[model samples]
Target chain A: MNLLLLSPDDLRADGSAVVEDRRLQHMLQVQRVEPGQQLRAGLLGGLMGQATVQQLDSHQAHLTLLLDQPPPAKLPLTLVLALPRPKMLKRTLQTIAAMGVQRLVLVNSFRVEKSFWQTPWLQEDSIREQLLLGLEQACDTVLPEVILEKRFKPFVEDRLPALAAANLKLVAHPGEHPECPRALGEQPLTLAIGPEGGWIPYEVELLRKADFAPVQLGPRILRVETAVPALIARLY
Target chain B: MNLLLLSPDDLRADGSAVVEDRRLQHMLQVQRVEPGQQLRAGLLGGLMGQATVQQLDSHQAHLTLLLDQPPPAKLPLTLVLALPRPKMLKRTLQTIAAMGVQRLVLVNSFRVEKSFWQTPWLQEDSIREQLLLGLEQACDTVLPEVILEKRFKPFVEDRLPALAAANLKLVAHPGEHPECPRALGEQPLTLAIGPEGGWIPYEVELLRKADFAPVQLGPRILRVETAVPALIARLY
Candidate 1:
């Protein structure tokens, strides 16, 4: 982990924090941190700075906090993605969070297997852990919020309109369409990417009704894990 | 698998092809092919077309090839990447191949763990298998050639010059480098990406001597798997 992320509960009243659990394991095994060493650390949803290691053991490490630097700015984006398979979904969570995407809406698509919706990885804690890993990897502090919409048509018709209001709405589909825009001056955008076999025409039409302009990333198809970052990087 | 890639050995004198092994498993289990069905197919490193399933059994599938369309064009790029951990390397191979990067060089970096150089994933058959999966995913026929340079200084100093000759050479380093270029009109280019913690100053200097201008992908540090496609997409 690039950043040592601490929850509020980890903080003591004396401006010190005690880190345990997986972070502690990483410190002991991966980092081999020393008592006097300072780690680039951040509080969850808060500031980022350094934490000087005060004491260490198998159980926990005591760290003094000095968070002052603001976290990096999140993208002005709300990604509306088809729920990928469980394996890809895990990586996509981390990928999106690392890229500074702050809002995500996972929706159903025709090609998305019904079995995908039943994965335990969609659990709240499981999702947060993956996002935390992304935040830690990128040295960011704030967590990206995730929303689930198991029903496609209702979410597109009832909910997506307001969520996409006053933003550039786009759906990243393959085939003949305009090239995915580059560095569009950091405008707030809601981009929907489809599943493996792509969104059927009816689904694309539904997204179109929500004012999402269809876009393409050329003729070559990419896996969702690869495409997410590619699309984000090209945008801004 | 999107494309059933046939090696020359699989071809019969009568223009029929026999596929068995893992591709057969995928065809039977996932695709559920019938006796007279057509699927997109391609020959390894050659043209792409369709395969009509002539017969199917648990052991093999006999297909008739009708190759007319050429595979999609490869990018005018050569990517030099630091050897990632084995798990990431597997995905990176598939990703680069899928994105039409026909040439890749995996080299050493100071930050790269020594054990990464020893991974079985770097073996010829293993690498080819991953690249084939990528080609199948993207509906392409060409396989990317992968070269290994275990020594850092020698490859960058001795070999990289010729490899990067007359191409737009770039190194995707983090920090105060110029922003990465976009859509340079398909000129031949060479890009080097570092391992997890990024390249040290010495390595960057050696690359600089070889005419590799340093470039940045903004502030967020992405995993290597994410960054590869990101860089490729933006460059093209």
Candidate 2:
């Protein structure tokens, strides 16, 4: 982990923290941290700074934190993604968090399998765990908000108008469309990416009607995990 | 598999072919092919077109090939990457191939663990398997050329200068460098990405001497897998 993340509960009143969970194990093993050594650290949903190892052992690591710096700015973007399968969902969650996405809407598309909705990875704790891993990877403290929309038509027709209004609404589709824009200069954007086989004609039309301009990334179709970063880099 | 890839051995002199492998199983189970069904197919290192199913059974599928169209144009880019861990290596290979990277050099770096070079994933057959999967994912027929550089300094000093000559040689480092360029319309580029912790100062200097201009991707640190696509999308 690039950053050692500590929750609010880990902090004592004196600003000292004792970590005894997986973070402790990671510090001891992967990081090979020792007493008196300082490492980059951040509090969950709070500030980021450094922590000095006061005491260390196999069971726990006592640290004195100096959380003075604000977390990195999140991307001014909202991602609307067709819920991927369970296996891909886990990695995509981490990827989204690491890439500084501010908001995410996991929406349903015609091609999304009904069984995908039943995955335990969608549980709050599971999602939080993956997001934490991503935050640690990117050394960021802020968590992105994730919204689930199981119904396609209602979400797009009823909610997406206001949700996408005033933003550069884009839907990444593969066809005869303009290339995805570049260097958009901090404009707020809402980008929708479809499932593996892609959004059906009806879904695309609904998105189009919702004001999402269809954009292409040339001919080579990339997986959602690959496409997310590519699109984000291009737009931002 | 988007495009069923056929090798030379799979084709018959009569322009028909029989396949009894994983591709056949995918055609039978995932694609659910029947007689007279046409699917997108491509010949390895050759043309891409349609394959009409002439016969099908549990053991094999026979098809008549009409290879005509050329594969998608490859990105005019060569990637120089520090060897990632085995798991990341597998995904990175697929990502490189899917994104149409024409050439790759997996090189050593100060932060790269020595064991990474020992991974079975570095084996020729294993690497080819992952590349094929990437090609299949992107529906492309051409395979990327992969080069392994176990020693860092020798390759960068003696060879990389000539290799990166005349191309836009860039080394992606997170620092006070200019942002990576965008949409340089078909200009060839050679991009170097370091390991997780990044290239040490000496290595960066060596690369600088070799004429690789340092570039940054903002403050947020991305995993190599994420960075590859992000950089490629931005450059091309």
Candidate 3:
């Protein structure tokens, strides 16, 4: 873990906290923390700074926090993705979070298998845990917000337009379309990426009607896990 | 698999072949093959075309091939990476092959764990299997070349210079460096990305002395799997 994330519950009025969970285990084993050592640390949903390790053991580590620096900037974009298979969802969550995505909307797509929705990885706590891992990996303090849309049509027709208003809307679909644009600098954007089979014709038409331009990478199709980072890096 | 890859042994002089392995299983169970079915197929390191299924069964698939089309183009770049852990190595191999990288050099570094050199995934057969899977995933037929450098100084000082000659030599490192360049369409390039813990100071200096300009991908430290695709996408 690059940054030790401290939840509000773990902090006191005097800015001291006791860590005894997985974070503690990571600090002890992976980081090999020592007493009097200062570690890069941040408060979840808050600022980041250094933490002085006061005590260490198998049980817990006593720490003193001084969260003075603001967290790194997030991308001015909202990602609308097809719910991936459970295993991919875990890593993708961490990938997007580490890339500094501010928001994600996991919407249903025709190609998304119905069984994917039943995965426990979609649970709020489970999602939070993965996002936390991403934050720690990136050494960022902010947790990206996530919204779920199990029903595709209603979410697209009723809610998406308003949510994506004023943003450059895009859908990463394969076939005869312009290449996905590059280095869009500061433009606010909302990009929808499809499933392994890609968006069905009807779904693409619906998104097009909603003003999302279709973009292509190339003749070769990339797995979603690889595609997300590629698209993100190219865009910004 | 997106494209069914056929080895030379799987083909005959009459251009008819029998597939009885995992590919057959994928055709039967996943693709749900039927008699007289036409499927996308490619010869290993050769042309891609369509295969007509002549017989369907629980054991083998009898097919008629008319291979004509050439495979997709590869990137005009050579990737030099620090050998990752075995698991990441396997996945990274597939990813690079899928992304159309034609050559890769895996070198040792100070930060790389010693035991990573002993991974079974480094074996030629295992590496080829992963690369083939990647080619199948991207509907490309050609496999990328892999070069292993177990000793650091000899390879970087003695071999990398000639291997990377006439290419735009660059290294992906953290800390004060220019942001990586984008879209150098047909210009041959060579890029070196470090390991998980990053290149130590001495390693970076040696690379710099060898004429690889350092490039940064902002502040976030993405995992190597995420970084490879991101760097490839941004660079090309």
- Candidate with the greatest DockQ versus the true structure: 3
> Every model's DockQ, to 2 decimals?
0.79, 0.86, 0.88
The better candidate by DockQ, 1 or 2, is 2
**TM-score for the A-chain in each candidate structure:** 0.99, 0.98, 0.98
Clashing pairs in model 1, backbone N/Cα/C closer than 3 A: none
Q: How do the residues B34-67 of candidate 1 rate in per-residue lDDT, one tens digit apiece?
A: 9999999989878889999999899989999999
The residue pairs that clash in candidate 2, if any, are none
Cα lDDT tens digits, model 3, B78-126, are 9999999898998899999999997999999888899999988999999
Chain B TM-score of all predictions, in order? 0.98, 0.98, 0.98
lDDT of 2 by residue, A1-236 (tens): 99999999999998899999999999988899989999999999999999999999999899999889999899899999999999889889998999899999999999999999999999999999999999999999999999999999999999998988899999999999999999887899999999998999999999999999999998887998898889988888
lDDT of 1 at B2: 78
DockQ value for model 1: 0.79
What lDDT is reached at residue B216 by model 1?
95
* Ten-residue stretch with the least lDDT total in model 3 chain B: B9-18
